[model samples]
Target: MPRMIFVNLPVADLPRSMAFYDALGFVNEPKFTDETAAAMQWSDTIVVMLLTHAKWHQFTDRPITSDGSSSLRLCLSLDTRDEVTEMNRLAGEHGGTADIDPPTEYPFMMSHAFADPDGHIWEPMWMDQAAMEAGPPAQTDA
Candidate 1:
């Protein structure tokens, strides 16, 4: 089986978070969803599990971190910089908050950061591996 990523995040309100992600067009995997958590499928193999704070703790014995004032950020990449902007915008429109700073621009990458309603920081970015390898933006001959 192909390696899969399961990003487990803690949410204050299960239903509200579900609605927020739903607006962004992520389908819920009912087989993996329940009252305490929901399995959000963003792609065929990438899965994110949104769990209530309590449920999150149940999955582990370690203390759960309250996102109220944390400075940590998690980055989720996308195919294009435009998609980053769109996702960050939609997040804000649907109860999430965009990062105070504007999207960052570099030679081969662009990123827009934001926080969920509960203040968990997330960055949606676009990075071209080939372009990055070339260093800086390539000069096209067109």
Candidate 2:
């Protein structure tokens, strides 16, 4: 079986968070979803677990952050720059904030940052593998 990554996040509203992810193209995995938590699958190997404050507390003693601050940022890679832009648009159309920061662009890549309703940051990016491997073009003094 292929290795998988499960990211668990504490959310203020379970349903809202699920809807936000759904808008961004994640499908809910019913086998791992319930009233207190939801499993949103981004890909076959990537799953995001959105848990309510109470449900989150059950797994850790740490305090749930109420402020709009995030300790970590998550990223998702897409096939094209257009897809990255579309993801950001979907985030805003649903419930999340779009373009928390200006979009980043390079000859080989593009990225846009967004924040979920609970303030978790996510960046949707696209990269040309061949160009990335070739590295940035060397600058020449004119």
> Which whole-number lDDT from 0 to 100 does residue 57 have in model 2?
92
Error of 2 at 31 (Å): 0.6
Clashes of 2: 0
Give per-residue lDDT, candidate 1, residue 44.
Answer: 83
User: After TM-score superposition, what is the CA distance of residue 111 in candidate 1 from its true location, in Å?
Assistant: 0.3
Per-residue lDDT tens digits for candidate 2, residues 45-84, read 9999999999999999998775877688898999999999
Ten contiguous residues minimizing lDDT sum, candidate 1: 63-72
Per-candidate TM equals: 0.83, 0.91
Off by over 4 Å in 2: 135-142
Q: After superposition, how far is residue 105 of candidate 2 from its true place, in Å?
A: 0.8
- Counting clashing residue pairs in each candidate, in order, gives 0, 0
- Candidate 1 lDDT over residue span 23-95, tens digit each: 7667899999999999988888788789998898887888666746765787777988889889999999999
